[model samples]
Target: MQPPSKTTPFSLPVDSDHKATKFRPFTISPPHMRAFHLAWISLFSCFFSTFAIPPLLPAIRRDLHLTAADVGRAGVASFAGSIFSRLAMGPICDLLGPCAATAAFSLLTAPAVLSASFMSNSTSFIVIRFLIGFSLANFVACQFWMSSMFSNNVVAVANGVAAGWASVGSGFTQLVMPLIYSFLINTVNLSSSTAWRVAFFVPAFFQTVTALMVLAFGQDLPDGKYKRSSNITGQISKENAFTILLNGLKNYRGWILGLTYGFCFGVELTTDNILAQYFYERFNLDIKTAGAIAASFGLANIVSRPAGGLVSDEMGRRFGMRGRLWSLWVVQTAAGLLCFLLGRSNSLWGSVLVVCCFSFFVQAASGLTFGVVPFVSKRSLGVISGMTGSGGTIGAVITQLLLFSGSSGNYMSTQTSISLMGILMVFCTLPLTLLYFPHSGGMFCRPNYPPTHQQHYDHLLQCQ
Candidate 1:
């Protein structure tokens, strides 16, 4: 066997004193707190805007007199915009750096959200919401930035924090938006139209504030921080970028992971977006009760993500087990079964418990899904992430379509459809377990081949 290469991409030089020097200024002085605070603040802002649209769907529907199909169509529009924006933004992030890209997108998203307040018809509403999704596509930029700043050892925690914060946005909207709506109706004496407008305005104001923070505090990451293929040549040409993305698509591992994400997120969006409506119809619960129950998913997701990462790391160290992909499949399958059972039950409290358990598993799976991303292609993390995220968006849109058409504006029909989707989700994981986990090792390391071969291409495409 050849001697171990001194410059293995996976290996990092250990420096005991280097850690001290790297953290000395931050630990000894309080100034480092600024970076932490700003980072989290920016993250929270992104999270808030990310979730703001879903929770307000009911309010928008009622105020605009839109049908359930209209609502679904609007969601599709927004997701389509997000998909397109991510495709463009991924390469831009790789070229321009995440800081400038995030700032630009954040500023652009603010105006889109603000303009949403003025929408009067479904056509205008759909257009504006799509624009909002396009602008808020800065989320990909933020993730790339975080990956560059934190080392691999701490990357799990950093990513978990960002994801957890994003999940919290749902709860924040649930807790605050209804109250704001009530106040607008009761105190401000506004019409339903204006009340919903104010709700959009609230997130817009916060988004603008976050944009300013990003502009002031965000910094470009140092070059050559993350892993990339050594054989990558040329100066990040546009052709090179497209080739990287195309390679990821051709790679079976990437598409398999993407499919897994698509199914899981499809099920997740179905349950989350429609949970309140399901409870309200099935159990005769009020909107408030339904909102509280639905909010549990986000709360559980936020808690489960970091826990999943910790567990993955511990298992890897102790048992040499890198079964995260399989584990997620199992978890989602179990959750699907629980959801089916919950749908069959009549007791409100019993349904809530089952739903909570389902949420926990789904969230855990969510965390684990992303936990494997950095391992896929350290160089092409951003573009790969965007591609996978786009798949999830497609899943979400499909789920929305199913919910829309099958519901027929009837509650019982919707529940039945949702239960069937859950069952389908359970089976979706089987192929993932058999195909993905067994081959995960290939994803973690670069292929050994001649530089001129297409099969040996470097993964890094862009930062933004």
Candidate 2:
């Protein structure tokens, strides 16, 4: 046997497969921390690429003469693409490992982002947005990678931070794209249209670069890249890809979690698509100002989502899965209330404050939702993650269609639609209260249920 890799000597807590128990954000050594950084950064680039257009939508709308219907359609299309791609990405991760799957996906999607500059009509804009949205599938890989690299005890924090940082790309692009647009118009002497188009090249380039880096340097498991026959510790290698996916699909918990994710992550996606435009139109703010405010919503993910995971993990340690469920329900319910208030605020500063709070809770709810995911089924982690991820996109699609779609013939005002969406979120949280696991129970279920045989087996594995 070959000698152990140099990075394997760290004293951090590790499990049977040597998956890390502690989450060190600054750590860059491979198989754990290195994978953490690469996973988040790779996902970050994809988020950036997918959302780069939203901040510039005002300009695109004017240039393309897009109606509100067209705009809503484009938003739906983007999430729709992500829904399908994320579903596919789960099994892909199971087959090739997240590293290879992510790299290949990024390379394939970057061209679509580049092609954004060519959008000349409503149809083309919607189609291009749809294609660019495929990059969000990297989210599944990011979460799967974190779960694979860290033990269950610290996995929430790992998943939270990785997803949180990756999501910052949405906020980062919101803040940066407008500045780029302004620079091109004011300094580079390009027209507004040309400048926005040129800005696409920036995210596309970064997406390509990050993809190449992951492909070259990223590790799939603690030991090495994934192999079909290799039995990596903490992972189920006996199951084929199809079997893995079917197992995940058959688990009712995955469906419940998917619905929970829809209201949290799905609402977040819809907000990202429309918030800048909302601020611009409602408050009469310039693109830069509106983008900046909207940026606060996405940027909140940096802290808010991780905080959710931290809380979930802490609760799990203290109160078991019931704690995780309570935290998810409480946070999500508050998010819905805040979301309702966000639409009702008449003053600009009030609106901003409510949105910031809403961001914290909604994103935190996302973190909490995923905190429960790894426990759903380790054997089918990828499929369950995919289902939940796709559920988020599906939620966005439904929200966009039901509320924001101007095709309603008698379109409700944007504010009213937003308020209505909040009510829906409140109703959605009800499902979380009903989810029960034989091992740890749920929100209203008995917390002291006797451990099932599988639970005992899992506990033994954790101890070993």
Query: Model 2, 338: alpha-carbon shift in Å?
Result: 0.4
User: What C-alpha lDDT values do all the predictions have?
Assistant: 0.60, 0.89
Top of the candidates by TM-score: 2
Give the poorly placed runs of model 1, Cα more than 4 Å off: 1-40, 53-59, 222-240, 319-321, 405-412, 434-464
Which numbered prediction scores highest in lDDT against the true structure? 2
Per-residue lDDT tens digits for candidate 1, residues 214-254, read 66765554333222333246343444667656655555555
> Model 1 Cα RMSD, Å?
6.6
TM-score for all models, in order of appearance: 0.79, 0.94
**Could you give candidate 2's per-residue lDDT for residues 44-91 as a string of tens digits?**
999998889999988999999999899999998999999989998888
* Backbone atom clashes (below 3 Å) for every candidate: 5, 0
Q: What is the lDDT of residue 30 in candidate 2?
A: 67
What does the lDDT read for residue 57 in candidate 2? 89
Model 1 scores worst on lDDT over the 10 consecutive residues at 16-25
